[model samples]
Target: MPNDKNNKTELPRNPELTPPCGPVKGQYRKGISSYKGIPYAMPPLRERRFKAPEPMPPWEYLRDCLKPGHTALQMGGILVDSPGTYQMEGKSEDCLFLNVWTPATNPEERYPVYVFIHGGAFATGSGTEMMYDGTRMAQEGVVVVTINYRLGALGFLATHGLYEEAGTTGNYGLLDQIQALRWVQENIEAFGGDPEQVTLGGESAGAFSVTGLMLSPLAKGLFHQAIVESGSIFSIASFAPHNRGDLEKSMTNGQLLCETFGTRDTTEDLYKLRRIPGDVLAAVSMVKSDQSVTPKAFCFWPVYDGVVLPKDPVKALAQAEINPVKLLLGYNTNESSLFIKGHTNLGIYKMLCIEIFGPEKATAVMEHFPVDDDHTPLERMLEIYTHSAFVVGMVMMAKKYASLGEDVFFYNFDYDPAILKIVGLNTAHAMELPFIFGNGIGQHRATKISNLSWIMQSSWVNFIKTGNPNFKEEYKGQVLWPKFDPEKKDIMVFDTHLSNKALPYQEDLAFLEKIMFGNEESV
Candidate 1:
């Protein structure tokens, strides 16, 4: 067996496979052997054409698997602004790859595997990003695999228009995830992982994907447990009926924009758009504040494609129609404060007026999330966008899933107070990730190691291993997180210390629900 002693050493033999992608590496303080950038499916470019993910053929020679695959298309703002160690320089349509980290190559040990799907609203992100390195988790005695599925125009372009022969329609990216899971089921044994003990996990859109997988017939028996951070099955970004109109509008706008950007010219003209350099495509696809909240800026979200997605995720979970997978789901304290659009000082009502009714109705929106002289416009703005967009929606989804009698765990991540102060982003969208992964990310990161990070990471690992999250140590320092019960209405608030607090804003959620359901009296 190869050395599994420290983070600096490399693994010994690959008698099971071909030449390694890079020298085997270790990470964190724990001993884990890692192989990066292994392809799981055929790329979705050119002739592959919106078809379901096809199997990746084995290589005649050993393929070095050290580096990560190219990230799918996304804006450079996120990746470039805070680039990390695993950042690949470029992207391509042929980017169907995955990475693995394991404690040992001994198949008999059969460690439980943790698969992380990255989030960029399904239009961006990759398994290769440094934020998702599996070395720390692997050192903790779990095998970790990160994957890159297609994204942007390549991944979710809704091929129903041209590829009727394909078994699936929209959500090629999701189908790619299914194929990756299938790869793990069949081949992870070779990497010292037990396929039977797979756990699927993600954040933001990635967490939303986890929820999607739980309901997917294609993903059944592929995973045993799930962890969702700062996101839920019914998050307001773009998954539900209210958002469907937006997606349709976005798609129509996207098609028109693509045509404007020269992506359409008969079926023959489509090739020119596809052939456009990625940077150019990325430039054209960028969603800016200047764009109208119309179809052109479509969020490129997942759809309820009957073949792959089957039904609305919430409806599936509500009726006990989904696969019987255990779940750990939660949202951050201030998710919207991180991604606030337009000026930071606008009041909530004004922002909503801009988002839903456009700038012309800014005065009218103030009637709903009206501002006062006492509160700053930023405060009012944060309240409006955060409440309607993320916070209230997450709480409702957690409650809906808990009502099902399944073992659903809920949390609110309010940690990283120090980092929040540093970055002026209070517990924002992806702050919990570096804490959980704990691989020492960017230079400006707040790094006085918190026991809370350890606690949450261990809880995630425990859920992956045993389908339960009560760690032996969790009860030692904090309030033991009770399983979500509808009657008690208990939820664990994960911050400096864990607490089983009654939800503080039930009435606000009620107000949002009334608005959604058209209870005009309440509204």
Candidate 2:
């Protein structure tokens, strides 16, 4: 990992700039000022475990905000430096830092700010993922902020011991995000950002966290707009430890985890869980996050603790109880293919439905996921998981927000190149990230691919700048994206030609809804 401890290394200095909180120096370029690893909260270790985040202690001396600090202790996933990808391991509990990319440092030029949360199934991922680079977005005239929050059991393990001590139970991770937003409101102006007009967004697990935040009363005034890419509690609930939250089950899981390490006493185990080395706890939590299905899949995720999240996220959004922020959400066409790496049979498919949708609805669910003669068994399996996990839930939320008269923009990303389709990840989960951030500047080898990415990138930043994603002038040959209407359900389909179409795959989604009863499993 890089030395991101606010080290006072001899580098090009931009003079000491003092803010309301502290004095920190950052590297300034011709048009932008960059700051990395700025602590927004004290590390969540030792006595701080399972508690709400505390403000970063103020410093008197000049602190160097240069490199990104340690990532919150996490098991490797697609977002981390993993074995299949890179080899860097950034795991630490002292990971409550936020990185800033700004166009100006002057307080007068208040720019629209976009704060991004990363996704890793709620157990992994770091904001420093190469694909989440904010330079291009900042250059497009919006201040960009990326944050890190605690993951795994450290973030979501709710228990009676915790409820008695802290009025709140689990959701320390969500609190970490709220605290970071508070820090932004307090300090972003010093870094050339308008805290008042912040837009919150993320992909997959980050998007799921965004869902939780939008529905959280504590996060009410912190953000003005939201952009959720490919996550929905209505769909993700299947992975939760319990659908409605069973304290007995939670206690049992905790007890077993303790017993695995030869600790039988519940009190002793709870204390040990808090006192053990950060990495050791993270390693244990990583192992537990997965179920019998796979090693990387997560079974432990966010829960509706009634305090942190008032109701199940699906119900909260459905009833218009969530924060009335400007909403933009969408899903990919082949989202499930990202998870379905191998072939499977009808028996396995039926078995998964029984586990996910329950036996009462499993047989009925198969009607929605029919195996057409033209499609392969693997394609059928991908469709079942994809539409169930992403498409239907996302569409339902957009309709809910639109019905409540909230400003909503919805889309369907099917802009898959031949290469992506050949690799079997055509418009798969998180595939739109590069296009949205325009992080593909150097990797592009073809004009068509470059042009598509440019349009997607401009649309995203434009939305951040004004809450409207339509950018026809700068990115020529791009179609206009209209506001989503529940009656018409005008969906923006992003392909070679960006066009508007009525909501697609409605019949299939309706069937899923009939059997699933609206996120019965998005745990």
Candidate 3:
């Protein structure tokens, strides 16, 4: 087994079919564990572009997974260079890799598996980031699987002619996720996991991916439980103005862009794009620093293909047409504020006006969220923006899930780290990840505020073990987390200490409900 820079000895050598290539050790758990990066499908380079994932050929030798496998090409050519972020060293067309974390000696323990999908708006990110390390969760008696799939234009471009030639397009990334779940269903039992107890969990775009899976008929029964963090149902209006027609036009526009880059002879020219450098392909994304480029204003995402997605997730979740799965969902307190750091309050008023009344209806929007004498446009902008994105919309989703008679658990994570509090980004989006994963340990500034890692992780583990997360009887540190109810609207507010409440932002939530499920003007 290989050793890290710290001189700690790793696990034993790979035995060809075992999960651990060497004994796995981490900050949380000490055990023999193998980290395997098994490829479940063929690469999507060259002629495989815009097609569904194909199964990979079996290999006889042991795959060296002491470290993470290759990551998919990050959209916009932006490398995943963030500290504490998951990353991969290599890139490839055949990058359908899945990483496994299991307890070292449990070849027969039958642990519950937690399959995670990383989020970067479906454009950036890999399962390789250190924050997503499964060793800690595996030490807690669960196997963790994180995977890499196509992103950006490579994953989400949709074309009618392309679909006519290829069976599918615009959703190859999602299909890859589906195929990974299928692979787990067929093979996770060999890795000491109860495939039937699989829980699909993710954040941001990953959370959206979970919803997409819930809506797809192909994904039914592949998973039983879901944990959606931060991201709620994406309404078509929020994402785009038109439906499939807009997506088709976008794809054709992308083809035209490729043509401008001297590859428009035929569809074969599209496959030739693989030979291009990473930076060149990245240049095609629409999210520029200046944000002036046209073509695809927003790049990468699963478009609504009638056969696969059938309809938008918001419509599906509202109608109860989504696949039945027990759900645990939550959002942060100040999500949108993190992005617009220095904006004035007046800017907030302008944004609300634009969203509610549109550019033409800005006058009406100004009436609702007005600017104060002391606040700037950006300051007001931050408040309304955060509320619109994180607080209000997510509450609507929780309410919908609870109304359907499903066992839904909801939370409002208001624990802001000291650094965030300094910048006024209190409990912004994705801030709760470290706490849930126990990464909040050892930090004197943040850790002193609260220690919810054990509670949060254990709660998740208990949920995987049993459909409900009420582990009060089995675990001592656990708190009483009741299922959500429409009438009482009980919720868990995570702060310096956890507390139960009727509704954190009851009035604002009612406004969101009127927009999402009631007959009222759009927000």
Candidate 4:
């Protein structure tokens, strides 16, 4: 156990600890000891670029983990200025670092672990982002971990030559995530974390990663629980221009990228691509257009690489071939508001709908969210995207988990702060993040935001600790969050007052289910 002596003089100012990987020095702050910028995998540069991450070799010296490390190479301005904004500085290809925040570093003290993955559409964002600081969550009695994985073409380019060399191509970012989890499994105990009690959680693309990891055989037994916020395999299936997990499209994109880099898809060219500067590769891989608006938005996304991701996640989930874990997942009410911006008339909205769902089904889907006096074209478009990209997908995942007799809890985050309301992005995508991390809210509405944050953090911690959100004594009088039932579709609505209710868009989701899943009774 950590020394309970609260006096500043009683604690070591700079603590040195030894984990399996190496001895590391960390700083003590507020009641938590943070070990930042711990390298979990070898630098993915030069010969290692576009390859599976190699475990970082143990060091004989005491490594300095006091400062933040480099983030995966990515283009700037990819993140929005919402609560979800992340720092994009100190970018590099040698970015396989993870940070840990723990109340104590006593190996005997086993606290539940919460490993967070950042969301950036799989192209941007970093674990070192200020918004992802794990101090507050660590204060709540659990060890918190955040990680960095390679992004964009540097992490996901797939090609025939690359496959011949590595036996698989693409999904390298996913492989990076898996490597991070393996590190947690091997070393979290030194940070006073119970590796067996680790809960993998994320929002948006991170949530997409949680689902991806759940589907990957390589990630099995890495995490015992999952908290998927605002995404699923269904989100990727609904949003990606090509089919979800389409390796062929990824390979074609890789060939195009090679051509863009003035090289052919040869073994020698693979070596040449690795030698190119990281910044130049990141700039070349940037997705210039808005993914939500552009139907053919070409981006460096994960592929169904036969090794890392053996098959399409949606198909794997449908076949009940997923890692069995207690699930707590949901989406915000206005998840699409962040992505769908600028001049969007009814014509563009209709075209986008037709592009996503075929012309035959587009008309039917439009009828569900019609533009009238109360609803503008933009409002309708955002609503359609919110449901299609986030809500329906989460609900489908919840139902599938429930069918498998897994402990699944579903939620709908509708707590809209006044600050966001003034900007017309109420309860937008990643709005729940501030509450979850207990940071980023302005002081004007501090009390209300703090109250919601308390509820979110407490519930999340409880779930991580016991696999049940309603396990705490304070939640006894409140509406008991019930397990999601496929028939009833029970949803825990997080708003001014917490309530257990039926899902909001039942009929719409059923229609979408039919459209997306071809009227199959089984999801």
Candidate 5:
């Protein structure tokens, strides 16, 4: 017989694990209600493959939003029980679904909405990834919505005659994002969220999408705040062109892809290209995305299309016409290490550099990069690549936006688990996601990071609640977070103990800037 003192009540069911059986899409998990696999637009198929997203017809029945909808046909990077081994099972062309998590179902209650776009280089990735489950944010008294948009060749392949026929061509994925936002504008209120207070955010290519939405005239009035994580102008040619040319770069890549698929770069052939199965196109896109950075850049990223993207975002930021919204932007410390392959010897490193940059220029660059016992030649070059991809652009964009009288907050994600560091991926790209999303790191999961994760997610929730990330009243203690203005240059470092740090990496930044922008005479 159980004693009264030792008796324990059975725990209630996890709300997230329980999906509503009714037509209204929702599941109960953790104390939050989630609506999964809710379609935001009609599925892109057949002739609709490369065209703009058409409006989703209203379903008469209560659509069961129980399970996660299909992910777009993309390269597999799903984090299964282990970190890898993502099989393509449910991915399909009918992948324009979104998941919503909210604390309340009552329409009278209005919570701030956070819309997250997933990152996979604008090619692969779905909102269904467990890392982005909105239950955590929803539990914190905010609405968190994750979306799945189109990707790769089907989403970004541009054609001239198709443009003439459809009146809008590529960046259909971007348009899908816009439609999702539009759906939120129309329906989030019913989910107990305020459409007026929406924050658009993403990591990697998702972050690129956020920036694109920030500058897009179509997205002008849609979102009130923006968050960019590890996205910058120098990430790749597709995200940002090295030059200001419009369709030339994207068109060339599109042509190559067309040729590879046995379709010509002609108006009539575009019809044939559209007929290519979604799975086939997605497979080809995955192969193309693996191409080396040199030779021809073939990423299917959004071009500076006149319709979707009014102007080059980098150029637009330079002109100071970017929509004035409260912005929270950041990058990890060892971003380039995500792509760096470890080398056993310095000769191989030098040879690879010479191959990439050519002999003379490689020699000059090699001489500039220092190598020591602790910092290997490979590590030093990875630092340079890190500075090139994340740091330089973060500084430039932060300074530019802050100087323009818009509110900006900056941080550097430096917290990494020993397990990840053991594998040579310390504070690598998108490594901050688990901490940010309240999911602990793999194998290294413990209570040690709980406090730090709490602080970060709390600040994010507060930022969603209000433009400022500071929530002294909720903290039960005073916490000061300063803005990242040109004058102050203040940055918050997320690590063991939160502390403010002055901007670092000046010398490497100067050298890289000179290499990128300086002429021999100018120097």
Candidate 6:
């Protein structure tokens, strides 16, 4: 609304907005007003640990929302420099906070809202990451929100004890996310955002969370649109054998974790486990592994508890029992590049392949990606993972949605900026974040990176605004992004020279889909 000529009047330097919970004061900066560190749920501590989030109590006084709040207790440096370096301070179990950015805080104005979930393999990362700052995106006349949910063991640990206590278990982090969206639906109007026009999005684990939320009955009408970048329902299958709906494995792992603390899976032991320090719980749940290879062991993740996620993702998609939302989803060319590194010999590659796909299917799958003089075994393994973990599942989901007559847009991000190419990260996983957020592009003005950033930001904002990326007139003739056709499978390729074309690696994707989904018709 700040962009509208009729509403161009100067706003107060310090803005105050009253929502259902309380009155919060936010600061104005360069025409954009932001509220940071607003708690959407009560702190999950002591007896509340590992339980479903409860709504924060209403406050009578104006709360200071100037600085970012504590991130969910997590090991630092999972995606950055070192432990405690990314988020130096303010890491606590009491981290159910969210941040908002808006062009104006006038309750009369109704702008589209985008609530993004940060991803760090469901363990690390926070809403306040520098790359996730919403100021630039807020300039596009949209309200932007980012949030921090519980992570690692503090967020997801399923056991019989937890099941007895909460009637379900293992998705406390996801419950935190759902609570945040509820807060948006209840309070976004005060921040000049339309609760009915909310778009939920995320990357990596966050993307997984978005897809999980789509299948979750509890999260069903909270959002109407979704933007999933570089992750999907099948992404977690690479690490763990059970589907997201399966709780047996997660419960077994939870018991094992409790055993590590010299405790049992009884209700009494649950209290003892909760009494452990947050940092100690985070540290004990940490698993050290080589970044080059896909981890074979199980880690804490969302489970099909028949409550939050009522059905297995594959079954849910097959039954079409998901929240039907306009979807804009895609993946980068080399999604596995960030996770896989170092030289992979043929023996190691074969072993990894056998580990992922069974020995019976490994040889057949290996035939599709042969190591050659130009394509080393490492490159072949990376390609195998990129398709198995990211591409196949994403295409399956997109095709499923398109088949159901949902407005679906798909993309392939192939833009490899020279700076990243030099380091062998050519359009790797999460490389598109800075561009989508309109950050980290000032230094690359001389190249097409800035222009590509503009294209992405414009398309993303248009999608958030109208549920159609091509709704804007400027994209009418020059860049016509077409809707994904289930039969044709057209995808918008994001690069220096953008084009709409059929998805690449079709044969490979089909093969992987068969291996992953078998004879399952619905995917």
Best by lDDT: 6
User: Candidate 4 at 382: error in angstroms?
Assistant: 0.7
lDDT scores for all predictions? 0.64, 0.73, 0.64, 0.81, 0.72, 0.83
Please give the range of 10 consecutive residues that has the lowest summed lDDT in model 2.
1-10
Q: Candidate 2: misplaced stretches above 4 Å?
A: 1-16, 79-88, 241-252, 262-269, 287-298, 372-375, 442-446, 472-475, 518-523
* Whole-model alpha-carbon lDDT for candidate 3: 0.64
Q: Candidate 5 residues 1-523, lDDT tens each?
A: 1112223222223232222222465566665778888888888887778877887866667676778899988764422223232346788988899988887644467789999999876777889888998887777788899999998777887666566566656688999999999988988877778889999989888887887777788888899998888876334432334222246666666777778878887778877887777777776656222111332344577767777877766667667756678889888998766655575257755654554444666676677885777778777767766676567666667777788887889998888879878988788888888777886442223455777777778888878888888766654323477899685578888886677877777666666555543422110
Per-residue lDDT for 60 in model 2? Answer: 93
Indicate the worst ten consecutive residues by lDDT in candidate 6: 287-296
Task: Give candidate 5 regions above 4 Å deviation.
Answer: 1-23, 78-87, 163-168, 238-246, 287-297, 344-375, 441-446, 474-479, 510-523
Winning model by TM-score: 6
Please write out the lDDT profile of model 2 over residues 1-523, one tens digit for every residue: 1122233133344634576658877776645577878888988888899789999878898889878888877664643334632222566788898888877644566788999999887677778777887887776778889999988778766655666666656678889999989988988887668888899998888887887888899998999999999877666545552432334455455555555666653443557658766666666556322222533322456666777787767667757887887888898888876676555666667666776777778777776567678765577777777777777767777777787888789988888778877877777888888878878653353576666776777777778878888874744565778899877888788876778888877777777865665444221
Candidate 2, position 109, lDDT: 63
Instruction: Score candidate 2 by lDDT.
Output: 0.73
lDDT of 4 by residue, 1-96 (tens): 434535312337678888999999998888788999999999988899989999999999999999988888877444554322232457788899
TM-score of 5: 0.86
The residue ranges of model 1 lying beyond 4 angstroms of the native Cα positions read 1-30, 79-88, 163-168, 236-251, 261-277, 287-298, 345-368, 441-448, 473-476, 517-523
In model 1, state the lDDT of residue 132. Answer: 89
Better of 2 and 4 by lDDT: 4
Backbone clash total for model 2 is: 8
The residue-by-residue lDDT of candidate 6 on 1-523, one tens digit each, is: 4457455656788888898889999989867899999999999999899899999999999999999999877764445646444332678999999999998645678899999999887778899999999999998889999999998888888888899887999999999999999999999998989899999999988999999999888898999999999888665666454333368878888888788788999887888988988888776445432345555344777888889888778778878988999999999998877766666788878877876787898999888788878788889988998888787878878988888999999999998778877877678888899999988786344667887887888899999998998744654235688999878888999888888898888877887888877834423
The lDDT ranking, best first, is 6, 4, 2, 5, 1, 3
